[model samples]
Every structure is written in C-alpha cells, then in structure tokens.
Target: MYQFAITGLYQQVLGGEKLNQIEKTGELTSSRFTVRDFTELVKIGIVNSNTITAFTGMWLAFQLNGISFIQNVDVIFFTIVGSALIVAASGAFNNVIDRDIDGIMERTKNRPTMTGKISGKRALMVALVLGVVGTIMLFMTTWQAGVLGVIGVFLYVVVYSLYAKRKLVSNTVIGSFSGAVPPLIGWFAVEPSFSIVPIMLFLVMFCWQPPHFYAIAIKRKEEYAAAGIPMLPVVKGIERTKKSMFFWVILLTVLPFFMFDLGLVYVILATLLNIGWLALSIYGFKMDDSIKWAKWMFVYSLNYMTILFVAMVVISIFL
Candidate 1:
C-alpha cells in the first residue's frame, strides 16, 4: 500500500468468472501524484531546485559575501521547499489545463493528465494547495519577495496559461517574463533592492527566450500544427521563424552592453559566443542543417544562459 499511497492510486484488474480472483496490483498505475512523489523528485535533483531554493545562496554568492555555511542550510530549506512546491503545482496545473492539447502533441501525449492517469479535479486541487504553500514560504522571506513569487504564479497560471496561451501568437513571451523572475527573486531575497543589474539579468533571460522557443517551434512544427497550437513556425512560415530567432539572439547579445560596464574580458567573450550563436542561427536558415542546427541551438541556449550568468557573477566581482 506504500507504493499506492505514494502515487495515490490502486487498480483492480479482475479475471473471468469461473475462478475469479482478486490480485493486488503490484505496479503503480497512478491515480494521483502524492506529496512524497513530488518531494522525492526535488530531493533527488531531477527537476531544478537550485533557482527556487537557492535564492539567498545565489544572492550571497553574487555578492561574494561570506556567510556561515550553517546559515545557508536554514535558508536553503525554506526557499527550496517553498519555491519547489509552487513550481510543481504550476507544472501539474499546466499539464491539467493543456491535457487535451497535450494529447494531440506527440511530446506531451504520455503525461499523466493527457493519459487519464490523473484526474483534472485532483490536479487542480494539488495546484491550489501547492501554490498556497509556496506563497506562504515566500512570505517567510519578506513581503516583497512574497509579492514577487505571487506575481510569478499569477503571470504563469492566469495571464499566460489562461489568456495568452490559447489566444496569442506571442504566448511564449508572456511565459518568459514569469520564468525569468527566479533570478530576480534571488537577487532580492537578501537585499530586496531594485537595481539596474538585476533588471538587466531579467531582460537578458526575457530576450533570450523567443529565439530559444522559435527553434523549438521549428523543430516541432508538425506537432504544434496537429495540436492546433499557433506557434511561430506554424502561423508564420519557417523562414519567418528563422528570422525571428536570429533577431532575438542578436537582441540577447546586445543587452549586456547597455546594462553592465564590464571590462574587455566580457566584451571579447560575448562577441565570440554571440558569433557562434549567430552562426548557428544563420546555418539554421541558410543551410539544410536546420534540423541539426535547431537542436544545437536549443542545447547551446541552455549553456549560453548559464555561462552568461556565471560571467556576470564573475565580472561583478572584479569590476
């Protein structure tokens, strides 16, 4: 029953009449997701717990300030647990809302909600519970941080999911705003000060998302079309999608210069990275290499953001 309790379901696959027998379903078939299941994912490092839980740690690291390692533990527990709950809730709810749409798309057809492994009513209940718990955790940080968390939730669940996702061609843009706020939340966790630096960090992420998603839409155009989701590549042409991706990558490259006054190190490094990113963009459009190039761009986008942020943290120290 522990396994059943963990996943929140049990099944009764009975045999025919003559020798009818009841056998306990050994394998978990999912009736609902339990807290234990979600928490275990966080504990094991499958989904991201860092950006959610490490707000104070990121702030401390970015500042290059020394704090007792002991203190970090206390901070990590509260921030990670709280933010993770919210993220999980948001994710589960997104699955519930998009289940019908998801079933039409190849990539999402196997999700619990899409497959009828979890009920809509149950998923909604979990989302609300997790959101409330997450908000409470953020409240423990400071009212400002709590407000930011709430904004992220509201932006994602309501504005993006409900209103923009189905109606707008630029749904991803609205979604990116909420996604990029994690670093900002980290920036403000300790200091709670609004600055050009943190705002720039947000913009870099904000701008980077379009191209990243454009590449994805290009790769998954047919799935999106089948799903009746009007992604950029589906509504607009592939050529338009490529051009849009190129434009956004250029925008991401140019953003750092306006915000931070870094030395030649950043300038040279960014130029080289941008050159590579743009080259991939160009290859995606001009060459027959788009399928390969789109995948490359997607992979590199993850690293590029990580390296860029790390560079920012590094530059913040010496500059």
Candidate 2:
C-alpha cells in the first residue's frame, strides 16, 4: 500500500508539471497571436503603404530643396514616424467609429473592429497614445507639421468619417483632403513656406483619390448600398462616377506640367501614367462589365501613384 501511494503521488506530480508546461505553451501562443493581431489592426487602420508614399513625397520634396543629409536624416526619422503614427491613430479612430457600419459592408466586415479581434476600447487607447506621442514628436520637428498632423486626424476621424461619410456623396473628396495632407506635412517639415510644389502635390493626391476610391466604390456598389454608405458610385451611378474619374485623371495629368521644378523626367512619367489611367477610365466608361473595368482602374491607380511619387523622388535627386 505504501508503495502504491508513492507511485500515485509521483504520477500526480508529473502530471501537474506537464499541465503547467502545457499552460505555458498555450500562453506563449496566445501572446504571439495578440501581437500579430495588434500589428494587423494597425495596418488595417493606417493603410501603411499609402501613408509611406505620401510621407516619402514630402521627404523627397525636402531633399529637392537641397537640405543637407545630416540635417535631413534625423528630421526624416521624427517626421515619418510621427506622421505615420498620427495616420495610424486616425485610422484606429475611424475603425472604432465605423465599427457598426463596417460590419454591414462585405469588404469591411472581416476587419478587426468588425470581427472583435481587438476590443474597441483597447483600439481607442492605442490610438490616443499614438496620437499624443506622435504629435509631440512632430512638434519636436516643426510646429507646422504637428498642426498638419492634427488637422489630418480631425479631418479623417471627425470631418470625413463621422460627418461626411454617411451624409455626403462628397465623402471621398473629404477623405482625400486628409490623404493629401501627409505630403504637405512632409513638405512644411523642411520648408514651412506655402509654395506651389506642395500645393500641386496636394492636388495630385486629391485628384487621384476620387478615381481610386470611385473605382472601389463601383466594384463594391452593392455592398455600399446595402451598408447605407453614400459612395459616389452608389449614389451617382457608374457612368457618372466614371466621368468624374476621367475628369480628375485629366486634371492630375495637367497639374504636373506646371511644376517646372520637376523637370522632363517627372513630366514625361506623369504624362504616361495619366494617359494610361485616362485610357483605362475611358474604357471602363464604355464597357458593359464596368465592375471589372473599375477593378482594373483601381489596381492601375495604386501603381500610378507609386510610380509618380518615385519619379518625383528620382527627379528631385538627379535633376
């Protein structure tokens, strides 16, 4: 009996250790998933690639001004990080505000906010911290940049997402204003002067967004309509939005010419990019399966902006 008791106790202790190990393993997995979810949530909110592009345009614009590398390195660090954080914060706030409506939209229904991957309260806290810290960092570089960052947050969260998004057909236009501000923030970070180049950059983004977003809106028309979102395509019909997109693309094409500082390289590239975009828009307008065309336009717009900005950087560096 004593021997049996000893064996049972030993088995129990071993089992207990195994259980503890399993618990630890489970906890480690949980921690990893949480970290991943948090990262995904940030990306979903900020649209990091687009944010980086806008920030890059600003940084390149500063470089074009002939600022020293040493001075620029630190400024680039603070400005990009701070601006990106603020953009993230704005995106998080948007997710929180739109969580309900987001659930109804097929494309947005699977988002962290919709799927409860992260709690809304936790998301808000993250946004607040990012916004405050980022704004402080931005102010360390330039007060103008900090202010522009704040304006971007307010416009995205309050003006565009909360007020305009549901109520106005011009919601894309309102949202574009926030998108355009990132480059301006970058521009003013180095050159506080309100110049034509920065304004043109802003206009380029502004014009680009309508077509970009309208294309998405067209592709997802039924979703927007079902979700009760007043997107241009949902409200204005496909043909109208297509016409609007072409008009914006034309404007985007012409605007770069006025930026004489951009030189032949940028002008040539911008012309090509706009022609392709304009041709695609015109084709979509005439196509029977306009949704497919819209999708093509959407993809092209992403490539268009990326190439245009890179061209801006290259010209700024070489010419």
Number of the top-ranking candidate, with lDDT as the measure: 2
Per-residue accuracy of model 2 over 149-204 as CA lDDT, tens digit each: 88888788777866788889999988999988888888877777787788888899
Work out how many backbone clashes candidate 2 has: 0
Q: TM-score of predicted model 2?
A: 0.87
lDDT of all predictions, in order shown? Answer: 0.65, 0.76
lDDT per residue for candidate 1 within 155-238, as digits (tens), equals: 776677655777788888888888776666665555577766667667877888888777788888899888787787888878
Per-residue error (Å), model 1, residue 156: 1.2
Candidate 1 stretches with Cα past 4 Å from truth are 1-29, 32-57, 60-73, 258-268, 311-319
Task: For candidate 1, list the clashing residue pairs, or say none.
Answer: 53-80
